[model samples]
Target: MQKVCWPYFDPDFENLRERIYGPTCRVSIDNESMEDCTVIKVDSVNKQGLLLEMVQVLTDMNLSISKSYISSDGGWNMDVFHVKDEHGNKIRDQRVIDYIQQAIDTTRETLSSSSLSSPKAKAKVYTNSTLLSSDHYNEHTAIEMTGTDRPGLFSEISAALADLHCNIIKVHAWSHNTRLACVAYVSDQRTDTPIEDRSRLATIEDHLTMVLRAQPTTGSQRATPPNQQEVKASDLQGGEGTMTNVERRLHQLMLSVRDFDEPASESSSSPMMPMGLGPDRNGQNPRISIEEWNEKGYSAVNIKCKDRRRLMFDTVCTLTDMQYVIFHASACARAGYAYQEYFIRHIDGSALSTEGEKERVMKCLEAAIERRVCEGFRLELCANNRIGLLSDITRVLRENGLAVVRADVETQGEKAVNAFYLKDISGNEVDMEFVERIKREMGPIMLAVKDETRRQSSSEKPTMPFPSLGGFLKSRIERLSHNFVTIK
Candidate 1:
C-alpha cells in the first residue's frame, strides 16, 4: 500500500489552527462503503486546519474523517489519518482497493471537469496579452462576473470598456439563451493602473453591472444565483483525508501532477490549427485577434496569423478596427507563437433582423469550430442553448470507441454549453479523419428523423454522471493501470 499525504499543511498553520478538540486533522476513508471510517495523520503546521478541510472532501464523497495524526518534516508537512464509520464492507471486500482508487480518481478529476469550472476554466481562457512562462503572470488576481444570460451581452461590456479606454484583453464567454445574457471576464494589461486605482476599477464594474442588470434572463437562471457558495477556499485545498489502497494510488498520481508548478511543458510541435492557425501578416507574429462582429449573434472573424512576436498592440488594433471595446487581455500562445484570443464588446447588436438570419449565423459558427478547433489530439464541438438529443450523440461516440475524459456543463438561459473533452479508449492519437467520421455519423443523429428520433428517445434516459461517458472513461483508465475496481 502506498502512503498518502496532504497539501494543506501550510508553514504558518501550526501557530494558527486550534487543536483543543484533540488535534483532529488527518482523514481516513473506506472505499467500498464511503461510510467505513478510520483515523487520519496530519502535520504540526496547521494540522487542525488541514483536517477541517479534508472533511469537506470526505463529506462530498459520502465518507467521514474521525481521528488524525498531525506533524511536520524539515520544511514540508504531512498528515495521516485513521477514520471509522459504521460501514465495514470495505475491509471485507476483495476489491476495496479498487473502490478506493475510483474514489480518488473521481475526486481528483471532479475539480477540473470542464462541466464544473470556476471562473478560470472558461471556454475562452486567455486574455489579449502574450502567453509567457513568467511568474508575474501567475500572480495576478483573477475575477469572474455572472448574471442573466442574453445576446448583445458581450457587446454591452465592450461598449462600457470603450468609454474607459480599457482595452479588451481577453474574454471567456458563456451564455444559456438565444436571448440569454452572458458572463465574461476581461483582463487588462494596464498593469500600471496604480495599485490604488480602486475608483477606476469600480467605475468599470459599475458600468458592467448596469449593462448586465438591464438584460433579460428567463427559465431557471431567473432566480437569484444559488447562495450555497458554489466556491469555497476549502475546495482549493485538495483532499487531505485517509485513503484506501486504491485511493492511495490515485492520490499519488495526482500528487505527482501537482508536485510541479506546471505540467510537463506543452510540446513545442506545430499547433494543430483547426480554427485560425496560420502565419500572420508579419510572418513573425501569430498574435491574431478575432472580434465579435455579428450584430445579433457574436462572431469571431479571422484577423491575422503570422509569427512569434509581441502582437499585443496589433491585436488591440484588430479589436478597435471592429469598433469593439477591449475589457482586458493577457499574453498567451501555442507552440511558441505569440497567440491570444480577445473578448471585445461590439458596438452594434446582432447583425440579423430575422430568425432565419440568426439561424444561419449559428450554423456557420458551429461549422467553423468543427473544422478548425483541435485541442491536443481531440476536436471540440460546442452547442449552446439548443434543445436536441444529447444522449444519442454519446451512444454513437461510445460505439465509435471515443470515451469522453472530461465534461463541463454551463447554463446561461435556454442554452447550455456542454463541453466534452474526449479521447480514444485506447490511448492513441485521434486523427482529423476520425473526428470527421464521427461528425458525419452525428450529423444524422442531430437531425430528428423518425427512426433517429425513436432511438434518441430510448437513449435519452436521464444521463448517468455523464450519461454514457463516465463509465467507459473511468473503467478504461483502471484497466490501463491493470487495477481492480469496486464501486462504492
Candidate 2:
C-alpha cells in the first residue's frame, strides 16, 4: 500500500527564512559612471511604494533626477538614477554622499521591519527630518492653513500672526488653481520657544481663520465659505503624533480642497492660469494620458511637460497617495522637456477601468505638475534672524503692490535665508525700478533680485510627437526581457 504524502508545516520556518534571505537593500553611488551626473543604483526586495520612498529622499536633498530606470519584477526591485545638483552639475560633495547613503539605508531597514505596517511607523520613515535644521523636531509650533488665493494674502496672514506675538521661523507656501496652502513653523516672540498655551493656540487659529476668510480687495470671488476654510495650529513639542512633511502636507491640503476640479471663471482670468495651464510658445500644454495595458493588467500613464525641479516628487507623491502601485517606470529629461511613463495598478491589483477614474487621475497629475511652476521674479533675502522679520518684509511687499506667489523661509542659526517669488498685484511684470527702490530702503546688502527669463510665445511646433503607447510598451517589454536573460 502506498501512503499519502502530507505537506510539512513549520511555523518557525517562515521567520527563520526571513532572517536568512528576506528583504535586503543595497545602495551604491557612482560619480565615475556618468560624465554629467552621479549614478545611484539600488537593489532590494520589491514592495509597494518603494520607488516613491526613494524618490522622496533624493528630492528632499535638492537633487535633480535627469534620468531614471525603474523595474520591479519577480518580487525584486532594481533602480538606477542619474542625478545632478540644483546647478545641473554632478554631485561632488562627500558630506552629501554620506547623508544619502545613511538615509537610504535607514529607509530600507525601516521598510523591511514589521513596524512599517503602522501609520506612525510610515510617517517616521518618510518625514524629511534629515533635511531640517539642527533644531529639535518639536522646537516650533506647526500651522497649516488653506483657503482662497488672492494678492497680498500672505501679507495679511503674516501681519495677523505677528500681532499675536508669534514669530515665523520657517514657512513654505504654494498657490494653485485659485487656492492657497501654507505650512508655517512659529515660536513665541518673547521666549523663542514653541507656544504651549491652549488658549493662545485657539486665538492663533481664530485669527488666521478670519484672515483667510476675509473678502479679497481685488474683487476675486471666494472659493469657499468661512466655515469651510481650514486652519489648524498644533504644538509639536510632545506626544507621539506623526510629524508630517511640509511639502507633502501642502499637497494634501490642496487636494483635500479639490484644487484639481475645474477652475472658477474668475480664476481663469488670473495671470497664473495663462502661464500654468495655457499652451506655451511651443503650443504644448501639459499632456497627460492614460491607457489600458491589457496584457500586463496595468494602466499606462504617460506625461510630457516642461522639465523643472521636484517634478518627480510631485507625480510620485500624487500616485502613492492615491493608492496606486507602480510596477515599472521611466523618466528622461532633455532640452527643457521631460517625458515620463509609468505602469501602475490600483493597490488591489486592478487597472483604472472607467473613464471618470482615468480623467480624474489625469487632472490630478496635471495639477501636481503645475503647482511648483514659479510664476514671477525670484527674490532672495539674507539677513540676521530676528523676531517679526517676516512680518516686516511682507508688509513692505504689500505696500509696494507686490504679491507673493511662492515663498520659502528658513532660519539657520543666527542667519535668515528666505526666498520669495513675486509678481505685481495687477498681474503684470514686476517693476525693476520699484524693486531697486525697495532694495535701497530695505538694505541693498540684504536683498537681491534674480531675473527669470519669461516664457516667450512661439509659433514653432514640437520637433517630434510623443511616442505611441503600443510602441513604448513593446520597447519596454523587450528591454525587460533582455535584462531578465542577462541576469540569469
Candidate 3:
C-alpha cells in the first residue's frame, strides 16, 4: 500500500509537521497540554450522541476525561472534556486517531441519510425559524419523532426545518438496518412562515410511514418476539390476539405531546403494581413509554401505568407496523427498595410533557393496583438485616391492629427484599400508613411501593383475542392531541 498519514489526536499536533503529510495538513488539535498530561477539546453538537458516546470510545482508546462540562439543548448536545493517557504519553497514538476517525465517520454516514452531509449551520439556524412560533422562541422546547425509520427521515425533517426557515444546531440518530430513531435540535423559523405548518409536518410523517410500509421486512423487521408463554404462529392465526394483515398496516405515525390541565396524580388513574411507583410530582412529567406490550398501545393518560403496573400481556405490541423487535422482556422489580424501575419507550412521543398532571396520573396507577390487589391483605414480617428497626416496624403495625399472615425475606444488591402477605381480623386488607410504617422501621428504602398480589379470576380463556392490539393503538393517538407546552 502507498504511504499514508492518519488523522492526529495528541498534544504534539504541531510537531506532526515533520511527519509525512504534516507539511501541508498543519492541523492544530484542540488539546490544552500540561506536564505529563493533555486536554482534547471535542466540539460537536451530539444529537445522535457521538460526543457522548465518544466518552466510552475514549475509554476504549485508553483515554480519560478529568473534567467535562456538557450541555444538550434541543437535540444538539456538546461535551468538552479534559483527557489524558495513563502513561502520560500525551495520547498521540494511532489507535486514538483511528477511534476518533471511525466515530466521526459513522456519525457522518448517519447524518448523510437525512441530507445533512454538511453539519454546517443547519440544526441551529433552523431552530429559530418562524414556522413554530409567531411570538418568541421556546428554548427549552424539543422535538421528538417516531415513524418508519428511513434514510431521509432526517432529510425530510430537516427539509421541514428548511421550509419553515428553521435552523438545526445538533441532532442524534441511531439506525439498525432499515429504520432509525433520531432527534433534531431546531428553533423558530428564520423565514416568514405561519405557525400553522402542522399540516406540513403531518404530511412528512405520513410520507415516511408509507415508505416504511412498502418495505417487505417493515412488519417483521421491528417485532418483539413472543415470550416463553406466548403461543405459536399456528395458535395466533385464528386466535383473537393475532393481528390481521389490514390491522398491521400502519405507515409512518406521529403522536405529539398533549399537556393535561389537571395534576398528574389525578390523571394517572389505573390499576398498577402496589410497589412500582411511576413518576410522581417531584420527577419531570416523563413522556409515556409502553414497553414489551403486545398489540396494546395505551393512551397517554393511561400509559404511565404500563411501566409501574407492568401489564404483562400474552398478545401483541403497543405500536403497529414496526421494524424493530424485542425478544424477551422481564420486569426488574426489587422488594423493599425505594422505587422499582420500568423500562419503556414512548416511540411516537404521544404523551409529551408531564407538566402539572404528572403526580396525579402516577397516583392513579397506584390506586388502580391497590384497588385490585389490596382488597384482602396479609402483613407477614420477615427477619430483616437491620434487626433494630424490625421491632419498631412490627410494633407500629401490631399496635395499630394490623395482622401478619405470611412473610419471607432475602438480600438483593446490598438491601433486603421482603414479601409479606397478611390480613386483619375482618378479612379486609386496609392500611394507609403501610408505606410510612415500612420507612419508619426499615427506612433508606429503594422500592417501598406495593406489589399486592394479583388474582385473575376464572379458568376459561376469558376473551376472544389473547391481546387487544386495536385497543392499544386507539389509546396512543387520542392522547397525542392534548396540548400542553407549559413546563414547571
Candidate 4:
C-alpha cells in the first residue's frame, strides 16, 4: 500500500511569508437592523487562508459569529458577518474596524514585499513571451501543475506562489493515476491586478515549474518496496520519527541555538513504561514523559513514537498552540523509530511543576500525534455562495453528532468550495448512517440559501435573503421563568 503523507506545517514565521495579501481591503461594521449584533462587511482580494485568519482575529477579540456570507468573484472577495462581543452587544467602535483594516493591510504589504525578495530571483530564467501574451496578461494568470502526489504538495505550491508575489484567486486540485494535478488562477499581489509584466510572469512560471519538478525528500513520496527503498542519510540515527530530508537539515540547524554547556548526565533520562495508545490503529504508541529539573528551573519532555511525515510539525505546532516555549529540543529518527526531547517552559516562563498541567500537555501531544498518524474521512463540497451557509453546515454536523476535525473553505466566482475532515463525536469512524443524515439535513439548507439568493436578485423590492437559522432554533427553545403565571 502507498504510504500517505501528512500535511506540511511551516513554522509561524513561514506562515507569514506564505500569507496572501490583497492589494485593496475595506472593512466596515454597522448595527442598524440586527439587535445586539454588529454587521461587518469586508471587500478585498481573495487569497488562501484569508477567511480563516480573519475569523481567528475576530475570535481572539472575543467576538462570536452569528451569521456570515462569503463570496469571491475572480480576484475580488466579499464577506459579511453578524457578530456580537462576549457581552452580547454590538460593536459600534470605528476604531475597532480601523484596527482590523490596518492589520489586513499590513499583511498584504508584507506579502507583496516578501515575494519581491524571493531567493528564486537569483535562479536562471527562461524567457517565454508566448505564456505572457497580451490576452493572457489581461486575464488571470493560470498556473497548471502536475506531479507525483504526496503529502505537503499543496503547501509547497502555496509557498512557491507566495514567494513569487502571486495572489491565488481560484484553485482546483485532484489526484489521479498516482499523480496530482492542480490549476490556480492568480493575480499580481502588488497591484491586486492582472499580470501585465511579461518578464515577471515568466519568472513566476519558471519558479513554480522548478518547485513542482523538485523531488521532496519527505517520506510522503510513495513508499517503495522494502528492498528497493534506499536509506536516507539523515535517518541513519536510530530515532523514533520520520523526518523529511529538508526537515532533518532544518532541525539540525535549529539545534545550534541550544546551550551545550548544560549539565549532561544519563541520570536524568526517563524510564517510561510502554503506553498502549493507538497501537492497533497506527502501529505506534505515543508516549510522553515529563521530568522537572529544579536546579535548572526548566522541565524536560521526552516523546517517543513511530515517525511519520510532518511529525515534527505536529509536535511543535501542538506545543506552540498550547503556549509552551521550547528552550531547547532535539529529534532524530532511525529504523522506523522516532524520539524527541525538549527542555521547555510555559509562555509565562514557568515550568510544568503541576501534575495537572503535565497530564494536560501529555494528553494534547498524544492527540496531536494520533491525528498525524490516522487521518479522518475528508469530504469536499462546492456550491453557490449563500448567507449562513457555514453555520448551517456546522449545525447539521452538530445535530448528527459528527465532529469536524479540520476544515478549509474558499470561494471562487459565485461558488464556494469547502473541504471537511470528519470524525464521530465518540472518536470513531463516521458510518454511512451519519453521513446520510448529514446529507439529508444539508440538502434543504443548501437549496434554501440558493433559493433565497435568487429571489433577492430577481425581486425589485429587496427582501431579507434568508431568515437566520439561529432565530428559528431560538424560537424552538422553551423558556421557563419562575415569575411566570400558569394559565389554564
- Which candidate leads in lDDT? 2
Candidate 4: lDDT of 346? 83
Q: Between the candidate structures 3 and 4, which one is better when assessed by lDDT? A: 4
> How well does model 3 score by local distance difference test?
0.32
List where candidate 4 sits over 4 angstroms from the true fold: 1-285, 293-297, 306-311, 321-323, 333-338, 346-351, 354-356, 368-376, 388-405, 423-488
- Which lDDT tens digits does candidate 2 get at residues 89-177? 98899999988888877777766774657432111101111011112455777776777777778888888888989878788888776
Show the lowest summed lDDT stretch of 10 residues, model 3: 249-258
Candidate 1 CA-lDDT value: 0.32
- Better-scoring candidate (lDDT), 2 or 3: 2
lDDT of 4 by residue, 1-488 (tens): 99999888856656443335423666777778787688887776764435534554565466655555555545566777667777768887778867766766665555446657643211121221011222242255554444443334455566667667766555444432223444455667777666767678667766765665565454334432232122121211101111222122222221211111121232211211101112234444678899998886778888988755456555665565466766556565667767778777787879997999898788667655653332345655555644334434445544444444334445556565656554444433334333334344443232211110112233345322222423433222112111111211
Per-residue lDDT tens digits for candidate 1, residues 1-488, read 99988767777567454543333232233333345444332333231122223333344344433323333323223544333333622234435434543543444345335356653321111111111111133232222344433323344454555555442322233221111112222334355222124455555555655665562433312322333113222111111122221122222222221211111232223121011121122223222224455542444433224222213322333233234433222333344343334333444633334555434333332222221122223333333322222333344445554543322233333333334444343333344333444344443122111110112233444222223333443343233222211211
Instruction: Compute the lDDT of residue 163 as modeled in candidate 2.
Output: 93
- RMSD (Cα, Å) for all candidates, in order, is 25.8, 14.3, 25.4, 29.2
TM-score of each: 0.24, 0.78, 0.21, 0.30
Q: In candidate 4, how many clashes are counted?
A: 9
Q: Which window of ten consecutive residues has the lowest lDDT sum in model 1?
A: 126-135
lDDT, each prediction: 0.32, 0.70, 0.32, 0.49
Per-residue lDDT for 268-384 in model 3, tens only? 222111121223322323333322233443222222222222121111122211211221122222241112122222444333234443453443334322211222234332222
Native-referenced Cα lDDT, model 2: 0.70
